[model samples]
Target: MSEPVDPAPRGGGVALCLPLDDEQRLDASARRHGVRVVARCSGASELAARIPALRPDAVVAAAQPQYLDAALVAACDEHGAKLVVVAITRDEQRLAAELGVIDTLAEPFEWDAQLEPAPGGPAPAAAADEPVAATPARGEVIAVWGPAGAPGRTSIAVALAAELAGRGGVVGLADADTHAAAIAPSLGLLDEAPGFAAACRLAGHDALTRDEFERVAEWVPLSRGGMSVLTGIGSASRWPELTAERVTATITAARAWVSTLVLDTAASLEHDEEISSDLHAPRRNAAALAAVRAADRVILVGAADAIGLTRLVRARLELLEHVPPERVIVVVNKVRASAIGVNPEAQVRQSLARFAGIDDPVLIPWDPRGFDAALLAGRPLGEAVPRSAARAALGALVDERILESAATRPGRRGFFTRERRLA
Candidate 1:
């Protein structure tokens, strides 16, 4: 059991999790230093859970490993609370740094200037809470985007990455799906600690370097070329960590290291930030927009049926507003005769050309068995089912579209023609 000690003098907040006598001493020392004792607890576990809710400007926890854990630091950082470990020994000071703690306060409860919190201490914030500059778009970045429906956005992205990697060039696959990331499971990646989230965290602190970015990337070997993946957040709730600035920085760093970069972005592109009108408020779709704006090319994926075609048309229009039509490659997935009652591929191509002005769009055949086998095996389509129709179509897409785009890299012009632009 822990005790709550909210003493007098409502001023800058200071949370304390120390022994009983130590708590009294620290409380008195804080008051002497003119700092308000906002919260006090006996156990570190209690403080860890309470820090975000309590919203103290600074926390002073004993240097013991139990009191100073990574979870406490993460919680404090998430809520904008600065954690200062109370270290009385050299080992404790080193431990604090090893645990990724921001700062450390020496024992004996001294009147240190760092202990004093700034005016208007932090308030309790809910747990849920950039565009690339024109500087030499380092490497060719391909962003994959689609509308609300599943539309096989991630599947297409994974297959595209595998194909790009098969070209024998260094490829970086980034799963930037903030809403619902499936790249880890889709590729059978057992990533308990996703690299994308870690990179984002480092980027937020301006500590992410090219080396660190590469270090976080997990290698996924392809048949021909080698590919590395920066998996998305562990869960959708952790999207706040993937800020627009961080996403851009991470992508830039990834480009610095890889020959080709493939980004799998979120489904929506609504400018929620405009509605909020607050820069601090987290925009859920910022990651998607940032990836699209920063990319050298964008892959627009949509399902093949009537409803899917309608959504794709509307989604394509919306996408065109942010991305130039020339750079967007339309892909229709799951094309089957049963769904459209005709030559599915031709119908999809005809509908896209007639309705969305997307001619020669790549149509992927529905191969449930092949897709399921690869998914269950946690391997790529090329490795799991090379004979799959969808795999063959994806390989064609790479050979015809991506490779050609790469060849004419400098000052590259988009593929959308004048008629399609007008239509």
Candidate 2:
């Protein structure tokens, strides 16, 4: 159907996808360094279109939304061209870097350095053909995520963390929700410290060691069956500070600090740049995406009612686009017969299977009294109301899914796969 374009040889061909002024400024450099501007494109689609014909060795574009996205990065990768971003601001630079651009130039550019060969010259391109598998983490990072209707993510996360901590190992609950963060208030902890954000900041600076991580994560009292807790920004406006890079780095470093980590993430997963063009703004949903992507498994929660289940089905489709189906463990919260009619669990399961193609989902029954009591007591369901149906349900999930036999789990790792869920 489509014609095949032969791969462009490595040369001084650079495609420019910049603003008019920037194009004028860099135009002179084309003549000086024997660099040729093979094509001029506007956005990602146009750039991709030109790639087949021009066969550029590199693409130079401003770090604005119009010039950058996953599509643009993919085009460069497919065409064997280096995507070099022209960034002026720190946010722009971070955005470009996160987009997987290895080469970048600040505004008021240079062609001599750009055209210069490496000190040892280029190695054989065949060296890059090697394939590698990532090592499994020594510890487990569980992300408790749900849609915006509030399907009880914090409660599930706290209960799950408590269940893991009950095994007499280090555990942590991190509030990665940037919107309406209530982990501190839910657990009766002080909220002024900006715990997780501070950790992200330290992670951004490469200063978050295990000790620093523990220090930033406040420890609960033994009376409450202690586990380390990292609070979130109490206000939603502070989301930008939790950049994807920092959140990812913090999550990576967390493997050594705790045996299990539970993260309560925000509902939004939209990549902001996809919606609106900007001068390289940080994504509002970066923390949630980063946590979900970084986690060993994601606990996708949704309320049992019609609206919640509807949202859940939509979330499942979006989530599966990012992670494999095996990485997801669906949970229907507040499962009551009154909400979803005669057979709530069956209805929920049927809906999921029909709409989202999910066969098995963990169903936690409605237990308002137990949750209210636990909330008032400022403790997890496991500690405050051990006999709660919700607590028992989540406990069972943690036990069966997370605390499997040691033989299957083996040693602490950064990445691994046995039969795991596949078994």
Top lDDT model = 2
**Tens digit of per-residue lDDT, candidate 2, span 282-338:** 888889999999998999999999899999888988998778889999999999999
Error (Å) of candidate 1 at residue 74 is 47
Off by over 4 Å in 2: 1-137, 222-225, 406-423
Q: Estimate every model's Cα lDDT from 0 to 1.
A: 0.71, 0.72
Q: List model 1 lDDT by residue over 332-365, tens digit each.
A: 8888999887778778888778876777788899
lDDT of 1 at 84: 53
After superposing candidate 1 on the true structure, give the runs of residues whose Cα lies further than 4 Å from its correct spot.
1-137, 274-279, 405-423
Best by TM-score: 2
Residue-level error in angstroms, candidate 2, position 295 = 1.0
